[model samples]
Target: MIDPVIIRTMKTVKEIRLENARALANEGPAEFARRIDSSTQQVNQFMGPSPTRNIGDKLARRIEAAFGKPEGWLDVEHITGSDDASISGTRSAVLEKLLPEGSGNLVTWETPDDLEPDDERVWIDRYDYRYSAGNGVIQWEVRQKKALPFDIGFFKALGVRPQDCKLAQVHGRSMEPYLFNRDMMMICTAKTRVKDGLIYAVTFEDEPLVKQIFKEPEGALRLHSYNPEFPDKIIAADQLEGLQIAGEVVYRSGSGLAGGN
Candidate 1:
């Protein structure tokens, strides 16, 4: 039989992912699978009303990383029972389930409602062209675009100017398990300083590519990925003429999912 703890955790995590996935893609499971580099069948096994797969610690970590969530986010404390109970009664029931019938103290979960956007909400432009995280992709100027609202506080904490930020969609498995395909990326265009191990949206002769940049000695540069199947690509300093750094990736969400505030 499947472990009860596994069932509880999987159910809760899948619920969270499903809620966010709707905002990310209208295509559903197939789009989600493309983002995580897993087959659609595997994604279904973990999600849906009746999940057939157990979510292990490894897979949990991968999911957290792919969606830019905090570690252990998938393992939050879950209280079992009926949904019809009042909020306070639900807490008491959960406490009863966890502790003895009469316990010393009771702890309740606080689920604050999401705040609605206000007049001062910041909106960053999102483009239609898919930025490649695998091999380079040829893309033209932004013919279509949309604006996504972001909390101004988030930008202040990152020290990034809101106007200089652009949200772009990633489109390749080259950065699988980290930056999955169809993931929405927050690119900071204010600066061009290359940092080792930091992801950047760059261009080679007008072709767009998203990769972690490492500056090598003698002015050479190396592009790296989380997947071992893809080899590192090196660009000599002399080839810098064709290279252009569009922006540095500051945040990522699975397949255009915007769980981040």
Candidate 2:
């Protein structure tokens, strides 16, 4: 016998698919498929009258990520609309439902609607790449234009220039208790100097990683992870020439500390 929970989940997925299709009516199916990392033909099959495939858990999560929706977003029923305020409100409600009480201030999904003429916004370059916190990932250099916006004052407060900041996402749990998977990091590209007891986004042997670095007395470097399961990696002074310090992790958003380590 089929489980009722499975049936309900499938129904929810279908509803979400239809709603997303309607929302992307202007961009059409091709763009929607691109966003979800699926082919247009597969998308049509899922949306067709006689469907041959079902939305699995992995695909549902991928859809949510592509649309910038929170996890389990597709499992619930949401009111679809063309109104901007209504859409924003719905997003806020979803976030509130997922976050713990008193932690609501940690995340904000809305852009400030009230800004004085003198208040300037700085756009930080964001890359469609993830820096592995466990096993390093091969670095990809795809920059998304106008990814994150910050108030000009924000840079002044951090003592870092706006132009020097870049945003990237972290993947893996090797740096757990300090940095979590899928955390959005604000990297100061200008600060490449090796500093002890600091987290950095670096490339070693062509693999990009987010790890805390400690300079040894003999000019060697130790890459550290907060999660004890992962042992620290020590690089000999002579091999340091291969290490490229892309930037120091100045700020992070997600389930981690906001300040640099």
Candidate 3:
């Protein structure tokens, strides 16, 4: 028989999971499951009424890491007061951490000089070139469309320098679900080294493509697509000369795109 203490602890963990689910309601269960490196079914089962499974130590750590929470954050309950001021303060604190200064109160600044020094915002160039995720496409010419502002802290958290990052749109169904058609991707040019299972923007035979790269033995490389409908492309050691890795895809913003493990 399971110990009563163990049962109570499991129940408390389940309750905490429920609270986290509520907090991440905007991302939905599927995204949350993806972030926690777990399947949707597992998330639903543990978060369900009268859950049959308990969140193990490994899964709890994954959840904390995925959500930017501290270690063992899920092991205890966080109490929030019923007062409106307390709730507002909590929300403000979250926003402050996630957003740049003065972002909470938006105002039109005629020039960069009008912005305050504490803004800590970095502008990333949004190139007009598209990286094909299906069949490769030639980048005729590189042109800067505009600069998008992002919090400097955000880049620091991702371990990417602001200047080394460039924004481009993904154009193909091959990388779908994770990278949909016209999804904006942030590529860290400094990280051109191939890391297995990580998605990258690359140039193959003068055509730019976005795909997950896997380094094989004998200096060969395999380009993989998220959509199973698209078969993986293998580049032999001899053919590697035609392949040029632009950068690692650090972030993607689009509909239904979730954080990958």
Per candidate, the number of residue pairs that clash is: 1, 0, 0
TM-score of every model?
A: 0.52, 0.52, 0.54
RMSD of each: 15.3, 15.0, 15.1
CA-lDDT, candidates in order: 0.66, 0.71, 0.73
> Stretches of candidate 2 above 4 Å error?
1-118, 130-140, 143-146
Highest TM-score scorer: 3
Query: Taking the tens digit of each residue's C-alpha lDDT, what string does model 3 give over 1-261?
Result: 986663333446666755554455346567878887777656656553334466778877777888888997877766455584466456546544654454433434665677677668897878744444333433424476557778999888898899888888778898988989887888887888898899988888877788988889999999999899999999999997778777899988876377532
Which 10-residue window of candidate 1 scores lowest in summed lDDT?
104-113
Highest-scoring model, lDDT: 3
lDDT of prediction 3:
0.73
